[model samples]
Target: MLAGKYSTLGAMPTERTFAMIKPDGVRRGLTAEILRRIELKGYRTVGLKLYQIPRETAESHYGEHSAKPFFGELVDFITSGPVVAIALEGENAIAGWRSMMGATNPANAAPGTIRGDFATSVGENVTHGSDSPESAQRELALFFAEGELLK
Candidate 1:
């Protein structure tokens, strides 16, 4: 199990978020650093796995971006390499993960953030994070099943 900083109780019941270390991040050998940050931020890694998603799965995962011109490219990029999928748990985990991820475009991310620290290009941004509670729930469901993420 991954180490985490957290309290037993809080304003929000223990929440969950889905996070991914994208291909570029893994290729750059930043997985441990990224996981360290997540742990240091108080989110427990309830579930973790390294897997290469098939093209169809990648397409379905990013289906919200299907209308965008970069949809095909996005799918290709994601399916081209193995990714680290994580289910994080803690109070406000969804929001916490997003703040840690910074902006979608590394150039727009603030200094000291994960993207700002390691990413150079928007398309090769190092990570993926759930944008909202609804998104977190939906994404978690897609990546993890019941009993997959433990307390």
Candidate 2:
């Protein structure tokens, strides 16, 4: 019955993606729910950790937005509280995670999405998912070292 879930090529190639339950999500006690959703979608958690992000690491993680006006606020918020870093592996992991996250702005997200259901604003959205495979590799490296990821 579940045979059509993927494609004729059999299961899609497994890929890893990076995700972070942001400060607001942690402060609001939504970590379990978020991770549960990921697991329920059939992805495997290869790596996980709870830690306060250092300023230097935060800056590097968000380097692409360094020139943006909200860059300071972005870094400040992420570094403000403890966050849960997650590395999830599965087929189409990057896009799947992003779809689960919904729109960047909660106001614009659909009703069933994580952001649509829990987030209040763009600045304090519940979670972060890498937008592409390249970003995933980069972000996973930032949050998790080679040894941290399960083979």
Instruction: Give per-model TM-scores.
Output: 0.89, 0.93
Pairs that collide in candidate 2 are: none
> Model 2: how far is 30 from its true place, Å?
0.1
Task: Give the Cα lDDT of each candidate.
Answer: 0.88, 0.94
Q: In candidate 2, residue 129 scores what lDDT?
A: 95
- TM-score for candidate 1: 0.89
Off by over 4 Å in 1: 1-10
| Predicted candidate 1 versus true structure: per-residue lDDT over 1-151, tens digit per residue | 2334443334676788899999999989999999999989888999998978888778888999999999999999998899999999888887778889888888889887899899889899999988887888888887777888886
Write model 2 residue lDDT over 26-139, tens digit each, in one string.
999999999999999999999999979999999999999999999999999999999999999999899899999999999999998999999999999989999988999999
**Which pairs in model 1 have colliding backbones?**
none
